[model samples]
Target chain A: MKSRFKTGIVAAVAAAGLLLSGCGPAATGAGGETLTFMFRGGADEKAAYTKAIGEFEKANDVKVNMIVTTPDDYSTKLKAAIAGKKVPDVFYVDPGSVQAYVKTGVVKNISEFVEGSDSIDLDNIWQYGVDSYRFDGKLMGQGDIYALPKDVGPFSFGYNKTMFDEAGIPLPSADTPYTFDEFVDVAKKLTKDTNADGKLDQWGTGLNVQWNLQPFVWSNGADWLNQDRSKVTVDTPEFAESLQWFADLQNVAKVTPSVGEAQTLDTYQRWMQGQIGFFPVGPWDVSTYEKLPFEWDLIPYPAGSTGKSATWTGTLGIAVSNSSKAPEKAVELAKFLSANETAQQSLVDAGVQIPNLIDMSDQWVKDSTTKPANKQEFLDIVKDYGRGLPANSTYSAEWYDELFKNIQPVLDGKKTAAQYLKEAQPKMQKYLDQANQAAGIG
Target chain B: MSTITRRSTLHRKEQRVALIFVALPVIGFAVFTIFPLLFSVYASFTEWNGISAPVFTGLANFQAMMVDPYFWQAMWNTLFLMIGIPIGLSLSLLLALALNRKMRGTTFFRTVYYVPVISSIAAVAILWQWAFNGDFGLINQALAMIGIDGPNWLANTATVKPAIIIMSVWKGMGYSMLLYLAALQSVPRHLYEAASLDGAGVLQQFRNVTLPMLRPVTFFLVVTSIIGGSQIFIEINIMTPGGGPEFASASIVWYIWQKAFNYLQMGYATSMSLVLGLIVFAVTAIQFRLNRRNQFSID
Candidate 1:
């Protein structure tokens, strides 16, 4: 009986060990240290991160467990994790969401961690990158630089080189980016029915009737909300004219596919398959297009009537969760991940994303494989000329949602652009007013 | 021991054990369900932005909800689905009658029809979306073959709500049919035979006999369908995101989700949810009253 009892205890111990080691607790190194890293890109991304952690572990006698999430639902999940007091040690914070996360007190301020650290250099970081994470001028990233902008997704218009060749148009040059009228004319000529069928076989461009069209409005020196981010500006003459031009691409010019036809596949999927030309996208598309069979090239968006080229800016940064058990250790990991030259190079080699460090971006620009396609041209624009929407802490997401909903009718040709703007602004003003009041920003 | 004392002691011990067993579950319910519901009710009257302290706002939320056009649009969309519940029930009843027979492969057919009942609504909605796609969708292809041009199923505002209603019926038909099938089985075969001998035709026999027999099941299905339809959130979320092409397909639950998570109007969202719950409660009460008056079994 004693022998049987001993055997049972041994079996139970073995079972517990298997369960605990599998998912609950990561294997410990010699120092028995574990660091958690949360990032946006999951799937194949975890492999690169796992390798990085292996290098970090061998160098520092610390084990790192990385949890990667898709960008779409990560913010909502991160917020929930913080609310439940189970925040990850380190996570990515996009500029769009940084304001909201900062207000919640769930993310730690990292000013002290960076005050005099020689381990990471802050001088090499870009001003915009630094400012993206700055709250009340006390770098929210602890005294140490919390986040290093590893890459910028700078928006531009792309076209299929094969389609340009077939159409017999000279490739767009820096001196003469297609004029607005010329751009429309080119799209019209490119859009045609090859088969005797009445339906057009090729679309010249994709409007991408989604949340990302704000750049077009901004390019015209107009925006969805007013300067203070307090009221909707959709009804302005510039916004209305922009909408008309957007809709006319489908209804009047017949250069773009209607929403119905566009639904056959998403605009990106269609562009990747070489069915459409001239889509507005970020530098990430260069990486995306590298995997596609089609040969595509990028062009700076045509100068708006204001005679200035415009692009949208999205910055990704590092943030420490307030509920972290070891805030100091977490800040260290965040600093290493954000500002380390070796770490940044490792991320760049995996993909040619723009690093937040201004000095590192020069190397990235030189190393870019998107040549003849010229990925550097877009990065140059972001460095020299680009500006982002004002990131208001109170109603950024709501304002964006409202702008999209109100413009959808205009895109579909159900309402004229002027009519849509007129109807949308007052309603938007109500939301902005409430948000401003809540934020104490009267 | 004295007999009376022993009996009393045993009774007390049994009661103590019962209370001990019930204690854990009662506490669990109070902590998880009852407390949250009460907290939400309190939250509906205040302004709280997830992290901050909530301030009292009285009936401000309700007052605003009364004027919000989107709130009314969502209510209208919900009512559209609520109206479809009866159409779905009657069709299921017909299908259940046809299937309730001694035919070859009857069990196989029954299982096949019951397949969708087990599959998730999201998976079914996605399938319907592909089927409804305008250019390459199977429905459009079929219509093209028949020389009839189909309208854009999801993109066109006029057709989106109808498309959703049709998809909802397709997704929901199997479960109600199974319920009616079970109810049909419980009716005695002798009653049908008696009705037939009394010189009634097939339709007459069904009207006089089967209809009356299935009243209880009908009442169950109608009440449940009303409750379910009034809370339709998933189909709108998955298929008709952005509230259908032009706000034509927005439902109350989807609007509540937008207000709370997207807009960060937590107090307003709570008030909207409470109002929706009250609307459902009133509708169900009215439905129960109408069902009682029209019940075939009572007549």
Candidate 2:
């Protein structure tokens, strides 16, 4: 009995040890270099990466372990990996993380690789995309390039073409944007009770204040931060006017879904069901949007007093881990993913992203057979007027988030935009100050 | 001398065998629980970005947490959520009593009630998110049938917390009800008979016999519910990604998670969690003390 008990305990301990060891990073594949690459996307993206990386793997003679996650869970999973000290060889990053990651030696400096590569012509890639991943000891956007842009996502505006046609409204110009007043007039005309019921079933526009407010604010010559990124500039009159205009689309104009109505089904679902007219479209959304019941096409967002459209372009960078054992092979994979003509073309064809290359995107624009017919609108924004998300340059986004925390009252029309901005500036500034202090960048 | 030696040898063998049985769990406790607990305690006093070596920050994170309005708001929100505990327990006990009766289809009713407890939390939260929709939701549509228009539950700041509370209670009552049912089944028939023989009315009999019988179960439910309720994260994350409108429904654990992972402020988050741990510990201790005098000893 004593011997049996001892064996049982021994087996239990062995089992426990095996379980703990299993949680560690996967063992290196038998006698060959293995590079782990982590990224965020759904099946279509994973499929694209799988095909594209196959070519790179054959050329480089290395095994790549791909860790995939959805956008929502990606950050938490990556943070867990970082905490465990099992950072992937190549991973997705953004401008916001560059400062902290670089300081902690989490990401490696890759300017030498970029300069030395004969295949990757810096001028061919979007300058904005490339600059987003650049960081020196103190500032972002200038200094050594630490990562390569996977894809630059432009937050472009799309209108339901069928809705416009049914309403006997002329199609919006691809090159020119509608003024705020023109956009409102069009929206009012589209907002109607289609079924002849007591309730209004169809509407002109449905915009989330957090996302849609930025284009309006930027076009009106206002911004969330100053040139030096040292101060919060959200309290200006232009910003308030843009905000008030956005709020009035729901409260005063009633062209958008009411808060109560939105709770039943979000604006995205409404747009998908042909109940709403205008919505924001990202490159990543093309495949899904293609299946929508209503026909839609890209348009420049409605302009403010400046008569110019503005929107935020989001990009994910492929960064090399500072602790990577196979840095050269990992960097080769990153380059192939970013700059390889076939890879970029295939990714674009997959409808997951616009071509990251300037020349390739130009070629892509010439093909007018795609659903969006006006694909140039994506490039126009990316090349001409698109700016980084206001929070992208900051060390932390708490400051950016503080601007929206109490913004409901304004959207509900309980508070004026000017009053809201006045109350919001100091709160945002305080968080920004804290973020800067944390980064030790003051 | 030989007999004494043999007995000592047997005793040592028995002790060794018992200790070998206990060894695995003890090691696991020390390695997984005790080690992380001590590390977090130390981390509470340091500035750790989680990627680099930790630097001691002394009381800075503590002082900063004290001034963090959002942290206090989360704490209050967490406390507000605990109000559902007693409400849930009371309703569950009533359910347990009803199910304890000799009724037809009691088993079916029990299974039906326990469905939510078995369902995944993420799936349930998503379903509830849709069900609480203000216009065409299951809840609002039912409310509308009674001549009332419902406000948007999650979109509105006033109703978000109450909406979450209602969801959580609906999700949690089944498990508590099952526990209470078992407790009720164990209550001795002779005790009720004795109370009735003493001329005790139904209410009096319930008060004198049933209530006392349920004391232990009630205590267990309250303590477990509070611990579970205080660490509410999954529901808030699913239903209200940005912590609901105006940060109205952000729980303390959700806030800690956001700070640590999303914002990469591990040091500050650790400090907040340590304080939260202390608060939960003190509350549990106080409950234990309060229950000591009133604890029903079957012996």
Candidate 3:
């Protein structure tokens, strides 16, 4: 009986030990060196990364583990990982999140790596892409580079050629700029009610204020921040005017679908189904739209009062984590992922992103023989007029998010542009001030 | 050793063995639940953003809560959501009484009713979102057929909360009904016969015997549902991105999540959570006190 009891205790202890082991930190790979890379996107993005990582692994003889998460859940998961002290070796960083992440000291400064490397040519890469990751130890967009740009996403419109042809409207030229009034007139002409059911089945365009409204706001020579990024300037007449024009597309002009109508079939789906006349397109949408039955092509954003088509440029950068066990290996992986010509070309071929290399972007645009006859327009916008979101300051995201949140009422026709901005500017300024205080930035 | 001593030794041995059997769970409860609970309570007093080291901030977070309109709005929304509990409980009782009859397809009906309880919240939220959609949803179409114009259920601020409440009741009613059905089955038939002998009708019997007997179950459901309703997160998160059309459907837990995860204000989030926990405790205590007077003991 004593022996049996002892055996039972031993079994229980073993079971408890096994259960506790599962809760412990994750094990390293079987090989000597292992690097974990976390990124955000769906299946196609995952597939592209998998292929690239597979090539990297074969070449270096080091195992690379890829963690893919949806864009919505990426920040939450990344933060949780950091808090748990299990930060990935490398991760995708966005400009809006750079300052916040940098304050935590998790993002490694890749300046030394870049400077020491013989492979990557800093001059050949876009200056804006590199400048976005630079921080002067205190302020962002200045000093040493912390990350390398994986790709640059320039905002433009992808219009359906079939819709234009069916309506007997001529296709827009790559260089020709449409004024605000002309753009609205074209939108009005494109909207139709095919079945005469008293409800329009087709929309001229769709406006997602967060993504597509920047071009309009910027083109009108209005901005959310002042020259030195010290104050909120969105309450100006120019800003209100642009916003009102965008809102009128949906509310007054009734060319775009209402919020309720859009919920049924989102703007993206409507664009895919050839129901929308114009929708914002990024290089990432090229692969998704390849299967579309309609012929679609890119066009520069319509010019506002300034007669200059200014659009926001979004870039995803490859960053090394400070918690990485093998920082050297991780840097190599980051370099391979971001700066390697072959890897960039592979991404370009997949139509996942435009090439980050200045020289290769032209090749990328010309190489795509499919739809988007005006693919060069994307390059033109990026080269001539593309600007990043007003995220040069640490407090930029807080103010930008506040603006996006408050501007919805204006779009819904619950409030006019002037009225909404008047109410929201103070709130935006408050958030900006708080964020600046937190970041110790004057 | 004396016989008493031997008996005491055996008893002590038995106790030790039981303790050994429960040791794993006790350790788990301590490490995972109790420690986190205590840590969060302490964290509420700090000014940590999850990444940086926490700085002691005393009552600043609580003070901020006083002036924070969003926090107050979330609290009001949470309380408003609990309005569904009483309505849900009454509906569940009715369902229980109906389903308690000796029907042919009772098992099938019971399974059908309970299915939503087992369904994942994400799946249910998506399903209900589609059903509540304004333009192409089935609910609006059904209403349209009756010559009534249905409002945008999820989009309109006025209708969003009611839509959430309706979905919550539908999803949760079955579990409450099952509890009621069990309680009803346990009620002695002799008591009903006695009531009938006194010339009581079905409704009178229900009021006099059924309701009185099910008081304990009702108390349990009420307390649990209130606590559950206050912590509503997934449904709101999935159905309404950024707390819906004007923060109309934002609940306390959703607000806490945004403060913690979205803004990285971990300390503020924990403070709000602590406040929510205290509120739940006070509400539960009051419920217990109210029910204490009834003194329904099975023994």
Task: Write down the C-alpha DockQ for each prediction.
Answer: 0.24, 0.54, 0.44
* Global lDDT of model 1: 0.71
After superposition, which runs of candidate 2 have C-alpha atoms over 4 Å from their true positions? Answer: A1-26, A263-265, B1-23, B296-299
What are the TM-scores, per candidate, against the unseen true structure?
A: 0.89, 0.95, 0.94
DockQ measured for candidate 1:
0.24
Tell me the spans in candidate 3 whose CA falls farther than 4 Å from its real position. Answer: A1-26, A29-31, A262-265, A341-346, A391-396, B1-23, B297-299
- Residue B285 lDDT (model 2): 98
- TM-score: model 1 vs. ground truth: 0.89
- Report the C-alpha lDDT of model 3 over B215-281, residue by residue, as the tens digit: 9899999989988998999999999877877788999999999888777678989999999999999
The digit string of per-residue lDDT tens for model 1 on B167-229 reads 888777888899889999998888878878888899998888888888888888888888888
Cα lDDT tens digits for candidate 3, A102-161:
877989988998865786788777777887888875666788888888778877787888
Please report, in order, the local distance difference test score of every candidate based on alpha carbons: 0.71, 0.89, 0.84
Higher-ranked by lDDT: 1 or 3: 3
* lDDT, residue B123, candidate 3: 94
Please give the ranking of all candidate structures by DockQ, highest first, separated by commas: 2, 3, 1
In model 1, state the lDDT of residue B295: 61
Give per-residue CA lDDT, model 2, range B106-198, as digits (tens).
999999999999999999999999898876689988988998898888888899999999999999999999999999999999888888888
Ranking by lDDT: 2, 3, 1
